[model samples]
Target: MKQFLIFVKKECLHIWRDRRTLVILIGMPIVQIILYGFALTNEVKNSRIAVFDQSKDDATRLITDRIAASRYFNLEKNLNSYKQIGESFREGIVRMVVVFPINFQDDLLHTNHAQIQLIADASDPNTANTLANYASAIVNDYQNALNNDQKLPYNIDVQLRMLYNPELKGAYNFVPGVMALVLMLICAMMTSISIVKEKEMGTMEVILVSPLKPFRIVLAKTVPYLLVSLLNIISILLLSVYALDVPIKGSIFLLMAESTLFTITSLSLGILISNFSRTQQSAMFTSMMSLFLPTLLFSGFLFPIENMPKALQIISNIVPAKWYYIIVKAVMIKGLGITAIWKETLILMGMTLLLLGISIRNFKIRLA
Candidate 1:
């Protein structure tokens, strides 16, 4: 116990002295959240539009006024000719062209139905969809104003209920994901590198041959990293809740408990890697290439799992961080409980057990 405490103290001293590690461990998440919130968003505003009104009548004028007032579309160009619409789209200043057909008001008065062509640049599908919807809504509003006396049967209005994230906030999506990545980097990769450093410095040999038990030495090496990882998690949680106002709809204690599980699992894997690695560089490179890349790419952090090919998705299922990410997302965003995340919990537990068994066996083999 004394020996473990001594080793933990040494590890703390090392962390306290290193300013670069401190900044990355603490400051990175805050910067990332701000960037994600301000820079990445789905809420379209001030979308550039080109209007080609051939009608030049009261109805067309009224509809154009509504579009301008709607705030969704910015009237960047009042085209002299319909030919300009095609040129504008090609130039990329305009996303959509609102073409009011010639004699639109006359047609509306006689045939009781008028149509305006909505041409959108489908290069960016999501933007095009939003642009088309906004245009349709404007036209609908104008038509409804003209014919408010008629009431349709079975008005089925489906109000959107964005569960978890009401605003569909991108920050909420990325925050938990970043937390998972950071924890894995700190707990697993850092611990492995730290142990490998001792070996590279010829200090691990002394520690290994010392009176301290192998398990106690391993425990000591992990203790400091465990503290650092937990501290990093705390910083992230505080920043996310207070700074970003991203809520923890589920149990905070449960989140911490899951974090602890994930941390220990990662640390154990680190120990396994460090035992075999001859140098810190090798350990760092191996963890980065093997664990970090896959965790970042395949864990559904930046990419959607549904969009990934079935084979990649199946392979991703085996990655421990993928399970951890799902657990964090469910707890933080969905506010789900044990009943909701039993499957993920089981998967994470399974990964932890597999890593733990391998680590223990490998450690024994080294001692022999």
Candidate 2:
């Protein structure tokens, strides 16, 4: 017990003493959370749009005024001709253009129907869709106001209720993802580098010849990192909840438990990497290349897996972070119980066991 405590203390000191490791462990999560929460967002605000109104009537002007007053759009140009619409889009000066035909008011007043053309730049499909929805909503509001005193033969109204994320804040999606990413980076990358650093410095030889068993040595090396990872989890949760207003609708205990499971899985992978890498540089490179990119891209963090190509979807299934991401969204956003995410949880558990078994075998062989 005394030797184990001493070993753990020694490992903690080593971590605390390294400036680069300390910054990455403590600073990286905070920076990533703030950047992703504030900077990267799907919500559109003050998008530039052009208007082409051939009618020059009250109805067209009223609709244009409503669109310009709304926070989602800014009427930057009033194009005179239809040809100017394409020019505005080609110049990249406008995201959308609203065109009202010459008989817009006459058609609306006499025939009770009119056409309003909305042309959006589909270069960024998500932004284009959002712009179209906003414009359609404005037009619908205008139509409802015009017919408030008259009754139509048939009317259909659709009520939209956004669940969990009512405001559609991107932080709600990114917080849990950042948690998964940070935990994996700290546990897998840092641990592998630490072990490889020991081997490079000849400390592994000294530790191997000591009274401690090999597994005990590995445990001591990992215990400090486990505690550090737990601290990071707490920090990320506090920042996400208090700073970003991201809610934890489900069991906090379950969230922490799953996070710990993923941490252990990442640590096992780190152990496996350390067994193969003799230098810290090689270990760090391997962890970054193998863990970081997959967690960012294939885990449905930045893009939805359902929208990805079939081959990439198949490739993403093998990523551990992909399963962890699903578990987190279920627990944190959907407020689901274990039954809802049992499949993902089981997959992570299986991966952890497989990685741990392989790492143990490799470490034993290295000792032999």
Candidate-wise lDDT, in order? 0.82, 0.89
Report the Cα lDDT for candidate 2. 0.89
How well does model 1 score by local distance difference test?
Answer: 0.82
How well does candidate 1 match the true structure, expressed as C-alpha RMSD? 3.1
Clashes found in each candidate (C-alpha, N, C closer than 3 A): 0, 0
Each prediction's TM-score versus the true structure: 0.86, 0.91
Clashing residue pairs in candidate 2 are none
Worst 10 residues of 1 by lDDT: 359-368
| lDDT by residue (tens digit), candidate 1, 110-207 | 99978999889999998999889988988987787888836579866555687777866677877777777787877878889888787768777778
lDDT of 2 by residue, 1-368 (tens): 89888899999999889878788788888898898888887679899999999998999999999999999999899999988988999999999999999989999999988999999999999899999999999998888788784646695656899999998889988987898898888888888988888877777888887788776787788888898888888888898889989888999999999999999998988998999888888998999999999999999998999999999999998899999899989999889999999999999999999998888777742443
Q: Cα RMSD (Å) per model?
A: 3.1, 2.4
